[model samples]
Target: MAKIPGVRPPDLSELTRAQDRMTFLYLERCVIHRESNAITATDERGTIHIPAASLGALLLGPGTNVSHAAMTLLAESGSTAVWVGERGVRYYAHGRSLARSSRLLQAQAELVTNRSSRLRVAREMYAMRFPGEDTSGLTMQQLRGREGARVRRTYREQAALHGVAWDKRRYDPDDFSSGDPINQALSAATTSMYGVVHAVVVALGCSPGLGFVHTGHVRSFVFDVADLYKAEYAIPCAFEIAAAGYADVAAETRRAMRDRFRDGRILERCSRDIHHLLLPADEPEADDLGPDVVRLWDGGSRTVAGGTSWDGEVDW
Candidate 1:
């Protein structure tokens, strides 16, 4: 039998940073295969090669067939591959996280498990939304109330500014088209936001299930992070798109969201904000992109070197 060589995966530092990559690229009705370091999408039109590391998320819509080699390259490049339904309204699955280190995940777990620390983190999240205002003394209920009012005001203001019909938000996950134009726009916009934020959350070695303000769901932390930029990006973009009276609200919303993400450098901001939330100000920064090292848990305060026998030193 002849021997075949496997493709060498790039070093973490050699790949493009998640924050610097394209927001997302959607493809349907195509066959995706690997060629060297890039993925090629072939269809009736032709074939297009995309550098795996340059992509933040690769959305595979309906009628898409992906080769295993292509997927492996995407994973190694830290580019998230999301399997979604038409217009990206339904999320089916996602690829592996880019994180090699568990440092941020440990910090998230510790903060979420303790009630005081959890509340403090929640307050910090709200504080980001309400700049120039102190939310340190406010209770959870108070924070929710304030946020609700602020969001409502934002919706009303945007509706009025865009000359669109103002109504309460209404969405049915099972039926995306049931809502009005504005509601549909909002849903589509937020869904896109979730996709991008999910990539960042996982790439940073953070657990999407461990959230500060939100709890329980697998993507609670994703929601927590997405909400931070809704007002600044998604909400306004949705309103603007809805007002334009586009026939395809969902499609237009996706394009608008992509532009906003790129123009505003939302990925960079998202990564920075997540780091700020998880890491303490005084704690020395660790190399998130450094080599993967496994350590055995000793206690909350420390960890011992892994892959070594400690039984001889400790007598049973």
Candidate 2:
């Protein structure tokens, strides 16, 4: 197949017809080595082996990385190479040039931020208390009306129902699948962005928890990265999933997310935008705060709010 002269090297391999095709995968949680028709992987649970030949498709990428040994094996065995790594994940130059620069990536990120902020504010302004409208409006009022629940009674029930005492306090509506319409709109917006963020995080090989937004939770800045894409990637996916019978009423799962990510209606240029966001040239130092969004644990997003300060802000 033809190649993009500047595209990152394709991860590939030749399945030796009964001859043995092999691949190696690495991630923060585990390491794996596999070959066509057979497979072996190592995790903290102590390397439980599995049959590798049965899979119809393999979706592997960054945040998860592979070892040099695996790369060497693929090179010797002529397998495809997929170099998705964390921000910290980098291999020395094997003589290949590089992707785009950080300035361009920052620019693209800025553009997406401006685009998404407008959608987010719009969704919040029209927070409706009931689900009277249809799904196509894509308006804020529709989002809030369809998704909100006062939950005042649920909190009261906890104290009265089973002698189980708890604060009858109202919680922040941050859960992606909450009943709040504005919350639903925000969730829809964020879901669409996950694919691009996932790809970028994998390429960076940095901890997804070390985020601009979100806390230093085990998941890392992964949610933060994913949040960046909500305006474009998530809204359409939510509507489609809703249309396909996964209504906007309940929570959506990651499985449903992957399906939506695979859908053809997604804007393909976002892949290029994702790639641009991960340009190796503009590597941020541990102390050097850059232009990316900073998501803190308190559900607030802003570099000025004691998270990593960014170069610009999108005021929608």
Please report the candidate that would top TM-score against the real structure. Answer: 1
> For residues 48-110, could you state the per-residue lDDT of candidate 2 as single tens digits?
554432211122334344455444443333233333223112221111101122443343344
Instruction: Name the runs in model 1 displaced over 4 angstroms.
Output: 1-5, 299-302
lDDT of each: 0.90, 0.36
Give candidate 1's whole-model lDDT. Answer: 0.90
lDDT (C-alpha) at residue 260 in model 2: 53
Q: How many residue pairs of model 1 clash at the backbone?
A: 0
Off by more than 4 A, model 2 = 1-196, 213-220, 239-259, 263-271, 278-316
For each candidate, give its TM-score against the true structure: 0.95, 0.29
